[model samples]
Target: MAIRDDYIKWVILITILYRVGTTNSVCELSVSHGDKLYNFSLASPTWKYPHGVLSEDGFYKIARNGTVLWFQLCDGLIFNHDPPRCFDCQDCGGPSHCGMGCSALVANPLGGYYVCTTIGRSSSTKVNLIDEKNPSMGVVVKISSSGVLTNCSLSVSVFCDSNGLQGPNLLETVGTCDYATVLRHPSGCAKTVSLHGNGLGWFSTLLIIVLCFFVAYLLAGTAYRYFSLGIRGVHAIPHLEVWLSLPHRIQGLFRSLIRRFRRPTQGHRSTYSPVNF
Candidate 1:
């Protein structure tokens, strides 16, 4: 009994291994920026969450859990936190048209923000000018599935007045992503009803074989009679045996019919009569 149990356990272990090795998720992502494009990422955070656990990997990896934001500089530096060059445009695209302010646009890799620049001139003797760069864009996030992983991507675009004053907007766009942990049941593993196995099962199997033999026997008798009618080549031994095994009633009727055919007809000439010279 112990040995039998061990064998069953071994089989189950093999099945589990096969299943796990084949199980994994696929993720993909793409981000569209102003003229240029950049790959978005989910990186570790310096500030801890409500429970002291730093939100790493991404903001919306699981949804409704963390924040998602991404920012890039003109020189090509990407950040998640407020950077020195970024300034807020609270009123420019916010509930209040405050026109200008500062806020957290990219909160990862240190607090960074996007900056929109404006040119100003002095009214003094010589033309003097002051220039300022402010956060002119916001982060757009996208996530999708890849093999065994879910990849999160981000991009930055120029904000128009039509664009809202939000810091991070989860733009749901049709894009590909490579993300991990998006596990799913593998194909061809789901349950389905199949006709191949639906034979009345073993009981039906036995019935089918018996029925086939019965049908073959019935056909063999009919074939024999047709063959014996001078059809020449059909009077084989196998056909004779099949015909002889028919039920008494059928056999009697068949023999009677055969006798009528064998009887001489009026057109027949007697072999014993001598031919006229």
Candidate 2:
């Protein structure tokens, strides 16, 4: 062992990045929500594919109600309109299974070992996952609803017949029902629990609006007062009148004294004037 270890001398290389090969290469996937479009490929093991599953080419874009963490085979043959179901062997003298007499199953690239037991759910609790070597393609989505976890699994192999990818966040199912629910509905919980007090949100919004109005009124009043002061300063400020005592009575007495004492000068007519003592 020592001699072999010495012979196999370890060589060290220095680099900033290293690369690993993954079998997630696929044609294209396009997903759409509303008017937006997004494009993605299944070539990265670390990459999580969003929903666009069987409807579009390789692009999908929208605020999703659910997410697609992994995408397996996406083909037109099996998943064109509806999901696949086993019909010929509904009661074919054996336990129920998927792909019993379906022509599509018979022509599967993988030997008839991997059976399609159920379209949506299965009795078995454990589900097996695979890579591209066996031509197995599937995707699992991890649904988080108010922190509750749920798994949704879909076999893309039956549809695409090609490649797939899986991420750490991808969920694996224990039974077919779990898988079916995940694919059918991605969001685990239909209802969300409130983190804060109920109706507090609306109350807070209303309070903010009221506060805004109050502040506006205060500002307007202050502005009006200041504006009036500014106007008085800009134009001339009016002065109040002041009074002395009994000026009108004194003026009447002086007028009587002047009338009794004064006589005409020369022939000139008396000039009219306010009487003064």
* CA RMSD per model (angstroms): 26.0, 28.5
lDDT of 2 by residue, 117-228 (tens): 2222111112222232321233222211111232323332222222342212333344532222223211111112333455458779999999999778756655665576
- The local distance difference test score of model 2 is 0.30
lDDT string, candidate 1, 77-181, tens digits: 212443233344232223232111211122212254444221100110010001112212222222211123323333323222222122223333223421111
Give lDDT for model 1.
Answer: 0.31
Backbone clashes in each candidate structure, one number apiece? 45, 15
Q: What's each prediction's TM-score?
A: 0.22, 0.19
Off by over 4 Å in 2: 1-203, 231-277
Model 1 error, position 98 (Å): 23
Candidate 1 has what TM-score? 0.22
